[model samples]
Target: MPAPPRNILASTDLHDVRWLRSSYSTGANNCVETARPRSGPETGLLAVRDSKNPAGPALLFSAGSWAGFLTAL
Candidate 1:
């Protein structure tokens, strides 16, 4: 068996992250996805999870923080 993915949040209330599909996803193979809250003033707190793991869990990051992460990649 493979190793489990590392949990990103130890005590985050994931109820607030609103998931959204990438308009560019092909929906046939592995594709990248993203999500954010529907309404909020929270800073640097965007939620992200794997598309294949809807029932699993998610990682939380600030909007700016997440942006910086992506930028680094």
Candidate 2:
């Protein structure tokens, strides 16, 4: 089996990543934004951070895990 994805201590650690918000989000800053690291150790993981706090910690998820999570929602 593959290893599980890990969480990043800070979203700022991911330099040069473009975080995107959901189209369903209002401009209220109450939602989360997601980004994919194109290179480095974070590559292949989905990075998620709170829109309310851009420099805060980000949670990382494997692509398959993220897909499963969305499917269950």
Candidate 3:
């Protein structure tokens, strides 16, 4: 009923997530990483973070928004 959680102050806060990289990405790690939190406040939402900074803040998006973003791309 309430809005989903927003930016995570530190990626480390998501202890249960498994960040995934795109297969199309190069080994340089320049792409953004995405994860779906299986537990905690972020569960069922998408978590995105820059590969260049693993410990940096992560932004969260709802499933509908994520799908729309991919469709828009």
Candidate 4:
């Protein structure tokens, strides 16, 4: 199989996707944000970005990888 992509796409360019913040987070933009792109190349992948930089680049991860990270945390 081919390798997964590892590119930092600008979060602002990911249009029409709803960015998610943790419920426990203050509205002060001091935490991380996540999103799921329903269309385009990002589809089926989880996108993460710093809430402090909405227009910054985002890191992508597979669902299983994200889950393992949470479990290891």
Candidate 5:
């Protein structure tokens, strides 16, 4: 299959996705939030968005790409 798009126009475009923030996040919504699309074209892809802008666009990454990003940190 072809690769998924690099991003979605808006996080709202993803349905039924449960956004999650790191446990290390403070009360301030400064950290990024992540979610996995359980259905639709984005299924199996990781979605990330700014916590402060839930309605903003989201960056989509494959599982391996997401893992490598975290491993490098």
Candidate 6:
């Protein structure tokens, strides 16, 4: 899939981005947090990372690519 737009990507203020964890993780605490840029102009990118490692690196993906990746899992 194509990469996310450069402008949104460059301006990704990860510190302020809200993240969501999988409910499927249950009480294990082994889940990742994710955020999708607000809908409309910046809706193509998806940000994800390990909840336990908030300061660690995050993985970004184009919307389509992210859907495909999730489907494969």
| Candidate number achieving the greatest lDDT relative to the actual structure | 5
lDDT of 6 by residue, 8-42 (tens): 32334454457788767776668877887666444
Q: List the residue pairs that clash in candidate 1.
A: 44-62, 44-63, 45-62
Q: Which ten residues in a row have the lowest lDDT in candidate 1?
A: 3-12
Which digits, one per residue and each the tens of the lDDT, describe model 1 over residues 1-73?
4432333442234456566777777777365445655443332356676777666566666667777998999
lDDT of 2 by residue, 1-73 (tens): 5564588878999987999999999989999999998877788899999999999999999889899999999
List the pairs of residues colliding in candidate 3. Answer: none
Count clashes in each candidate, considering only residues at least 3 apart in sequence or on different chains.
3, 0, 0, 0, 0, 0
Model 2's number of clashes is: 0
User: Per the 3 Å backbone cut-off, how many clashing residue pairs does candidate 6 have?
Assistant: 0
Q: What C-alpha lDDT do the candidate models reach, one value each?
A: 0.57, 0.90, 0.93, 0.85, 0.94, 0.66
Poorest stretch of ten by lDDT in candidate 5: 1-10
- Number of the candidate with higher lDDT, 3 or 4: 3
CA shift of 10, model 1, Å: 11
Native-vs-model 1 lDDT? Answer: 0.57
Q: Which one is best on TM-score? A: 5
**RMSD (Cα, Å) of candidate 3?**
1.0
List the candidate numbers ranked by TM-score, top first. Answer: 5, 3, 2, 4, 6, 1
Pitting candidate 2 against candidate 6, the one with the higher lDDT is 2
Tens-digit lDDT string for candidate 4 (1-73): 5665654667898877899999999979899999988887778888999999889999888899889998999
Question: For model 3, how does the per-residue alpha-carbon lDDT over 1-73 read when each residue is reduced to its tens digit?
Answer: 7777988989889987899999999999899999999998799899999999999999999999999999999
TM-score of 4: 0.87
RMSD of 4: 1.6
* Residue-wise C-alpha lDDT for candidate 5, range 1-73, written one tens digit per residue: 8767789989999999999999999989999999999998899899999999999999999999999999999
Q: What C-alpha lDDT, on a 0 to 100 scale, does residue 22 get in candidate 5? A: 99
